[model samples]
Target: VGSASIRPPATAGRRVPQGNSCNFGQGSRACVRLRGHALFRMAVRNAAPAVLGNALTCHVVAGCDVAAHAASGDTAGGQARGQAWKGLILRGWLRGGLPCGGQRCGSMRAGSCQGSRADVPMHGLLNARGQRRRVLVPPPLLLPLLLLTLLLPTAPPRCAAATSPTTRPEPSPQQAAAARGCSAEALLPLYARIDDDLRHWAAHGISEQLMDKALATQTTASGEKAIGVLFESGVPYVVSPLEEIDRLGHHTGLITAHLRFFEALRETFGPSIPDVEFIVGTADQPAIRLDRLENGALPYPLLRFCKSETHADVLVPDIHFQMRAFNATLLQQLDVINSVAWGEKAEELFGRFSQYKRIIHEHIPTLEVHGAGGENICHHANFELLFCDVREHFMKWAHGVRSSGAPVDVARQPRIKMIDHARYKYLLHLDGQTCSSRLEQLLVMNSVVFKEESGYHAFYHHLLKPGEHYVPVWKEGPEDVLEALKWARAHDDEARAMARRAQRFTQNYLHPDALACYWFTLLGRLAQLQRFEPGRGRRAYPVVLMASEYLGSNAGKAYVQKHGLSRMELPRAKRVEQRRA
Candidate 1:
């Protein structure tokens, strides 16, 4: 009887149509409507095993007698049975029997698994009662294409988690200390007590736009801020111009040295800080240089000003042309702006204090000075001021020396290039814009350094005492240069001792580690003085320093290169000379 239900009996109305060979039901209009549905189900049932595997093939092969049941007019019973059959098919599909779970997954239309394995032909077949019945299936293949499709994701992946605030990782220990809010908190003690006061300083230089774009990102221990810029290559950071203030005529070497200091610090510390955005101001000198007030108001809270004088939040070393000694070989090769050699420590370049006199003895007279050039006892005044230009104060002093018929040589005119220091026993040191890096270099040379007293000083300056490390000359006039020259000639042994003392100070205090300590200390103090608006805050410098440590010095270089930042050029005596003129 079951077989008969599957293969219905042929009767007067059930006779096969002219081209069709299906027995849908006994003589009835409903039977005509069913048409080729029985044939379609039978063909599919028989052929599907080869395409859909046994798991799915069995469902079609053993389908219920829907045609007979529906034709009997047992509406309630037939509908229940139809639902049961549908459930069976659905279960089979969902159980990984069809590619991408077929229509059973509810993501696609029934029986139309688009892009399914083998594109098995499918159609909705009806029974004798005109109710939808079985779906047609095709022959299976050797490949488990359906299974493969089932394994694939139903929809595209999303990036929502990455952007979610909750998903963001809490900052590390160092980061917590450098967080924007923490930076604001740290500054609370030293800066504006009220919101208006903080804003006042920000408006003066550090605008919120500037903070959001640069200063407020993250913090590092070394206190280096990376400006957003692109390399001739590429890096992954906010790209912006390197210089914040567009003013020209500032010292670019100062900028480069600051960058290298950060790079070296980051290379040293591992995770004590992180990288952050930074913008370099184009100020010609520190905002508050010495006792001279360049600005009557407070500077940007985010700025780490190279302390011009006392009462500064942070103290930064003067541009250490000392960095140049390391690039002795490469300096001549790079472009003008990129030529200020740095990244090497002072101790590394010239050895220890003990070896100073010997090295100076060997390297002195590196080249011969024309016009009455002689040994340490030359006819020309041992004093030679190889300056591109002379300040009025220095000029007046030089004029006085000439008027007094002093033996010292005054190369004060513009275009007077740096000459060899060997032939002369007395070397004259001067300050143009601020303290010169040449001060450090001259102190190391075995020659007697005749320094003019000025308000400007450096990290190693305080350690230098008159008559102990150098011969102090008068800044008001040129008589001091002559007076110092006379003293040096009169007391050769004592003058040499002063030069030795200067060399010792550099050796003991200017090592990279020592300088790094100074850098770290200055940043720490500066962080303590920073203040912020009620909610607005920049990152603590520590975090910025740590990030550099994480990314490493090489990464820093990559960033600079990617942004196509040129090296900061050391101010040439010639340029200053031109400016003075």
Candidate 2:
């Protein structure tokens, strides 16, 4: 271990500092004079533990040569001397003794210790030669004042640990409203009910008397009264004139046209008039009112509509025979003209005519085909060549048949063999003629020409009238004509077979009851009435009846029960109800 030591001065220097170390250990009050003019320097070499109840003082002089040597960059020799000097000062203060004044001062006394005043050094030995140098004193007397300066109030400990700011929120009106419940509204209209017997009369052309009798005994659902009538009839009309013309001949045209016209009229006028049973043909017979017309005649009649209110009748001409004759004559003339104009080798002419004939055969019936002999006779005449002459002749023939006689009343005529045949044939001819004429008129009005070379040509012909401005002209070679004619013949056979089948179907299934049901449904819807509601009030509900029947064995009963409606019988007197205010 290396031992280090610090030596004190023997005499006081020329200018002794007040805080310099002094030596005072001998017993007398004599001062030890030190002569060397060296400075008093102190350095702390090690930090000592602070003594309790002691005041520590550190003094640093401006021009002192205090040299230190530390082993670990801390507490070196000079620093240790400084620390020791501080320790000595602190020890003197703690011991309540005065500090050593200077090298020339008297030795320190033991009883000369009291308070902080004892820590201050006297000024007598602060100069050389023991001269008095204004009696300088250390600032230990101001120690309490220095401590007061360091006791400043620190910031509150909790306040030093604060953070940021805060905020708020809002609401939505739409969200609040949705939480409750709200919606919109609307409005509708109402209708009145009619008498059951009258309702049936208005719908199916049935007698009100029958309906009244049936209803008088008929029972209804509990809490509900019957206020409408139900008529059961099955009738199917030839509704499509074009289709009818294709199936039937020109002779059926009259009836076909009438049917079309009446259907149109009903569409236009039926909605406006209530309580009207529009009838077609003659309604003078009791069977007509009774809804007892024989088979096909009742549904597809030559007459159109019969308005009960005005007793008005719309008759459609029955010209089936006329059209058939017309078509036959025209074809014959065309063949004769082709044979004559082109001679035996007139292949082109023949082909053209053949094509024309094909169109005719495709649309018209075979009985309407004219023979070749007649065609040659009128070949030179323009009208004859064009077959107009044949058409005129056929028209005259139709008129003759119509004017011949009143053979049998359609409704009253029973379905006996000869009688039914006559009625069916006559009606068929009439319907065919009506359809053919309409087609012909339409063609002519449209300026459509039937020329072999031109095929079917149409020109703008305002003079031909609005509905009949388009015409078809045929154009084909002789070969084409022959082929077309053969095709037409084959097709005619097929059409006849289909027609026969249709007639059978109509006779078996399409009855008066069926027609009554169809008409009831149609009129009910037109009148805006509801189907019979049995559980509902006696007030009549506007309904539109559909033509189709309900399924199941008890279809009729089920319909009434399910729909909650009541039905009145037929042939009843009209009921009189007081008008509501």
Candidate 1 residue lDDT tens string, 1-581: 01122221111122111222222233223223323444334533322222221012111211221111111111110111123223333343211122221112211111210113323233212243434344433224412433443454433212234333223443442343333223334333322212322343333444445444344342221133323211110011223333331122233334435554454444333133322233333222333222333556443333333323342322344434334432332223224312222221111111101110110111123211111112131122224312122244344445555567655554434332232342346667765444455666666554567775645445456567888888886444445465567677678678667766775665555544444444433333332333332120333222222222223346445544543333432222110010111
Across 1-581, the per-residue lDDT of candidate 2 in tens digits comes to 01122221221122222333422223211111111212121211011111111212211211111111111111101111222223333332111111222111111111111122222222222232333322112245444432442354322111111110001111122221122111001000001111322343344543333323323322121111111222212111221112222222222323333332223223222222233222222111111221333452212111222111111112222222132332333322333322322112211101000101111111112113332233321123232122222333333333443355422122212234221121121121111211222232212111111222221111111112211221111121112333433332355444234323333332222222222223333443433432232211332323322212121115434433443223221111211121223
lDDT (CA) for every model shown? 0.35, 0.23
> What overall lDDT, based on C-alpha atoms, would model 1 receive against the true structure?
0.35
- Which candidate gets the maximum TM-score versus the true structure? 1
Q: Estimate each model's TM-score.
A: 0.41, 0.17
Residue runs of model 1 more than 4 Å from their true location after superposition? 1-257, 274-282, 289-313, 319-405, 412-419, 528-581
